[model samples]
Target: EAKEYAIYIGKMGKVGLMILLVTITSVVCQKSRDWHVGVDTVNPSGTVVHGHANIPLHRGDDGNLNANVHGSRVFGGPYNREQTVGGGLQYEHNSGLHGGLDATNMRGYGTRYSATVGGSRRLGPGTFSIDGGASRLPGSSRTEGNVWATYSVP
Candidate 1:
């Protein structure tokens, strides 16, 4: 029957399109590297380096494809103090799926590792985000979370 044939062709077409999209996304993620650098002053002085990749996986044109890897070195200034090294991965999809893992050294203290999951959506002139995760540090482990909003006025 023509109806059956058409249905079969439609299913195949969808499958083929999905395969193509996945291949293209893999290639783009492999090739794209947008590097960024910054300084953090929360504890003495620290250097932060971040690299990002964009994948075309957004349903809305206003959203972004984000994947980032970052590292930081915190050193005491003008005095000898605890020095630490930290690194993490940050990923956020336009479809509101976000999560990452982070690890850090605490000088004389043991290392800490944590994982976070969160979601964000556009709010009035800003974005609202909430996330929670647990950290394993030295002799103990703890969990925490917070709700935050950011706004950029153009």
Candidate 2:
């Protein structure tokens, strides 16, 4: 009987905490000129998180320089979807040039910091992107630079 009472008390405590926090996260969403989005975070991903910022740059009615950011930290072990994996900074300019660089801090165990720089150019009917950056921590470092090309679908 005593053991049962203790177990019940512990269970109640956890339930009370979840109820309090869940109330504040009942809804997660974002909206844009051509898109409206919503995410139900109470389930698998745990919390619907997203970005809907207007972006900081643009070239013209048909040209654009947009930036974006997103993040999530989940719970549980096997599904331990919870670990500090990677972070990065990116840049883009009008004329179809898009580039990004990222770093994985303690990718699976601890913490880290990273940085990146990139540029892009346009070719006859096609666009090219070039990126260079590196990540470093207490005793480890990963450096990389690359160029990729792609043409429009139409």
**CA shift at 141, candidate 1, in angstroms?**
3.6
Whole-model lDDT, model 1: 0.51
Number of clashes recorded per candidate: 0, 1
Which regions of candidate 2 are displaced past 4 Å?
A: 1-68, 77-81, 85-89, 95-108, 137-154
lDDT of 1 by residue, 1-154 (tens): 2223323444354344334434443554665544433334443542222222333334354444444433333323443234455666666676666777777776677777888887776778766666666667766756554544444443
Query: Top lDDT: which candidate number?
Result: 1
> lDDT (0-100) at residue 18 of candidate 1?
38
TM-score of each model, paired residue for residue: 0.46, 0.41
Report how far off residue 48 is in candidate 2 (Å).
12
lDDT of 2: 0.41
